[model samples]
Target: MQVLIANHGAYLSGIATTLWLCLYSGVLTLVVGTVIAGFRVSPLTPLRAFGTAWVTVFRNCPLVVVLFFMAFALPVLGLNASYFVFGTVGLALYTSAFVCEAIRSGINSVPAGQAEAARSIGLGFTQTLGLVILPQAVRSIIPPLGSVLIAMIKNSAIAGAFGVGGDLYMTGTRLSSAQGEAVVPVLIGVALGYLVITIPAGLLLGYVERKVAIAR
Candidate 1:
């Protein structure tokens, strides 16, 4: 353990970077997914089709494939971003598909009568979704949304394989080699690090869900 902290604690720094990657990529995923979800639910046929295509393409693809494309192929194509940047972008794009679906499902969970009520009151589709449907949907989807975020944090490990610096897995591997404590403890530590992020996030989301839950 001390070995991990030695030399300015490179492993700890890598864990921090991993956390940052998850945070940034998670935010990007949320934004992109929300837009795509809007597209999926839009009254416009073209928008729905585009959203369907987006989900089909990204969701079916492997995370590693997306990561490799961003990390290696893009660089070959004259795009020069850091491994961390490209990794985060790839993660966001891939995870955004799942996020979109989860949110859309939440939207569907909303009572259809509510939308009708909004429309009868002279509210537009956007207004109905923004003001009436989505807010309620959010409550129903909190558990799934929490799952998606936890998945995102775990998936961020893929970035480490591609040389994204300060990543948990990469850092763990380095610490194992440098510290000579065998592999199990190092990996356990890595898993614990992930739990540290995920457990609290899940608890917090649960708290929010309860706080916002509609009266029975």
Candidate 2:
């Protein structure tokens, strides 16, 4: 408690930055994942192929490897983004691949007849997806997507290794090294900080699932 309070500003700054990155990455992941899920469920062969390849490549590869490639390889290719930007982008892309699969499974669980009925009512493909399919898919996917969000938050700790500042892990590293302690307190502090975000998120998702089940 003493250590935490003494470094309150540092800890708070780190948590704030981590939360910002997590929120940004999670939102981007949801959007990208949704698009890929749509493609995977589409009838177009090329779209399916593209989505399949994306999920395969990202899901199969280690996220740290992806981050390394983004940080190192992208600069060599003349596209240099900041450490925070690159780390968040890589995390989003990698996580989105898994999110895409989860959402695709949810979409597949929806009945094809609903889409057909929407089309019979003169709705275009996009309109049918927007009005009839995606809402149900989203409702089914909320719990799983919440799990993905928690995973993404935990994974953001790796940003410290990539030279991104203001993450909880990075701040902990700085404090631990500066104080020359055994790192137990630092680890505990970081864990608690993570729980501060993840526990509430889990509870909220649980509540949503219960509400959805009751409605059904």
Candidate 3:
């Protein structure tokens, strides 16, 4: 398309930035979500409440508001960072609640018998999760985590609207504005760019899911 050929450079940069956003946000979400999921699954009442509060608050809040706070409000509290950092952190925080829930669901999907059996073997709660529940939870965890990563790619576009530079959605919007009547092409380019990441991720995770599926 003329729009793409004329602005391939912008598209390339946008695609790269989108990928970068997905990378850092996805990794941080997984790590923090695991901890929160652990908390949700913990035997301690306080820990469970803390995890519940975290997911309830963040999950209910709109992501753009969270990003705006991270970018604008954090400076007043002396927690300033670059736009990329703020954007990545906001995306991670917003997405992690869902990740925590997904992982918690996987943890729940693990049979009650496993925990009881672990207890019968005298294993403590933490040990039982690390040794028994989580490892087996891996089968269910993969599919949801893949979905999270895909969602992150789409959500990362929000960063550009907030003035995070080099974002694909921003690039497409800018090109659309410049090209006058080619808005459709610009948007299609963005969609294809997103699919570039999500499609492969879906395939890989599907393969992994098939490979690790437990006979149930």
Candidate 4:
């Protein structure tokens, strides 16, 4: 109500910040995750081992610890950057583990005979994976990938608490605690801001899933 009206500009800025964080982190997550998935499925034992270690560590470790390390520890080592950069990297790396697992599951779901057939035609490993396997696997990957991305959107709120200000969570905090706005109304606005992003995402993913299912 009044709280939202008064802070409309702030809310819009917060929403934009959240979107930027999600965009940067989401792209990185997919890129890193795809690479890790390839490593996990590679013929090289060393690559597979490295990929396994990556997923095991990042997936098992608490995200707060990862963000803390990125935000705090890296600066001490002279890798200084803005909190936004650290938050984006931490979020991406943490979420990439889950993305890797989802992609790996999709890879596993692809029929073995397809890969064999590709190889029989003299396609190399990379060629088979890039041209044949991943294309087919993408159908299965999309649903889980969408779920992971949605979860990542929610998780971005935590980054605001860790000094990555200018996000919806920080906006609400500022309004409620600093500006003396009623907590409930401010929180309602914050929830709506989140829904603005996530609901559309969920619906779009649903549509894509249905379309892919039909094509399959």
Candidate 5:
């Protein structure tokens, strides 16, 4: 209680930083993941293999390792950036693999006939995916996408440990240690900060799911 009161400003800053990370990373994840999902489902063998390899590697690799590579290794390779950039990029790339799978699963849930019909009407692969298949596939995509986003929110905490400052995890733990406060309360506050983002997201997902179901 005292800890929170004393550090409310820090906590707020942390939350804002976390949100910034989430916003950028989430956008990147969706964009890259969607493109990769297209690759996974593409008619071209090379595209499919490349997509498969992407998912296999990133999905299997630990998040910390990815962050480590992004944070430490990239600068050595001439890509100098802030810790925030590295963290955001790492989070996005790692999460994108899961997003790709979710989208692929949704795409696969769509019937083959839909693609065939679209092709018969002279739709190219891109047109078929965008105009015909994806609209139908969206219903199945939501639940998994929601789950993945929630997981991503949780995963963002790991970024703090890797020198991404001003995030909730870093703020809470650093303040607690510096002040010699109880770790539990500080952590609880951190958890609540996360809930501030996630609970609303869950509710939003629920609302969307209901609307999608009704539309179906």
Candidate 6:
């Protein structure tokens, strides 16, 4: 208890920084994912292929490798950025691939007839996608998007390994090494911190899903 209290500031600061990174990355991922998903479902073969390849490459590559590349290779190529920025950007891109797939699945769940109806009303492809198909798809996507958000939150811990300071996992490691104690409490705190944020978001998404179902 004394150790925990003594390190409270470090712990809280770490948690706050990590949570901010996660939230920023998650929002960026969602936007990128939505656009990539749109490209994937586009009629143009080239666009579809490009989007597909992007998803495949990002999804299949190890995230640590991606982080390493962002930190080292990108700098070598003159794309220098801070470790925190690089880590967050890399995580966002990697997580966006998964998010794209989830959203694409939701888009697929929408009936073909909806698009057809929109077309019959003389709606252009962009308008139809925006007003009709996407709205319906969003109803089915809430739960999966929530899951992706949770995954992003957990994965933000990897930022610590890349030397991004003030992340929860990094603080835990620092505490363990400095105190020379087993890391159980530090690990426990990290887990509970994650759960506190993620579990409520998950429940909220569930409630939103239920409401959407009732409305439909």
Maximum-lDDT candidate: 4
RMSDs, each prediction?
2.2, 1.4, 1.9, 0.9, 1.0, 1.5
Candidate 1 per-residue C-alpha lDDT over 111-193 given as tens digits, one digit per residue, 9 for 90 to 100 = 89999999999999999998999988987777788899889998988877888877888878777786566687677778777
Per-residue lDDT of model 3, residues 1-216, tens digit only: 877788889888988988888889989999999999999999899999999999999999999999989999999999977899999999999999999998999999999999999999999999999899999898888888878877877889887678777878888878877657388888888888888878987898888788887544
Question: Per-residue lDDT tens digits of candidate 2, residues 1-216?
Answer: 777777778888888988998989999999999899888877789998999999999999999999999899999999988999998899999999989988987887789999999989999877887789888887788778888888998999986679788788888888899777558877788888888878887898899888887877
Better of 3 and 6 by TM-score: 6
State the lDDT at 181 in candidate 3. Answer: 38
**What overall lDDT goes with each candidate model?**
0.86, 0.87, 0.88, 0.95, 0.94, 0.87
Q: Which stretches in model 2 have alpha-carbon errors above 4 Å?
A: none
Q: Write the per-residue lDDT of candidate 6 for residues 9-71, one digit (tens) a residue.
A: 888888788878887888889899999999999988998999999999999999999999999
Off by over 4 Å in 3: 178-181, 214-216
- The true-versus-predicted C-alpha distance at residue 73 of model 6, in Å, is 0.9
Off by over 4 Å in 1: 1-8, 178-181, 214-216
Steric clash pairs (candidate 4):
none
Which regions of candidate 6 deviate over 4 angstroms? 179-181
TM-score between candidate 4 and the true structure: 0.97
Give the alpha carbon lDDT tens digit for every residue of 1-216 in model 5.
887888889889999999999989999999999999999999999999999999999999999999999999999999999899999999999999999999999999999999999999899999999999999999999999999999998999998788889999999878778877789889988998999989998999999999999999
Alpha-carbon runs more than 4 Å astray in model 5: none
**Candidate 1 displacement at residue 112 in angstroms:** 1.6
Question: Candidate 4: misplaced stretches above 4 Å?
Answer: none
Error of 1 at 140 (Å): 0.6
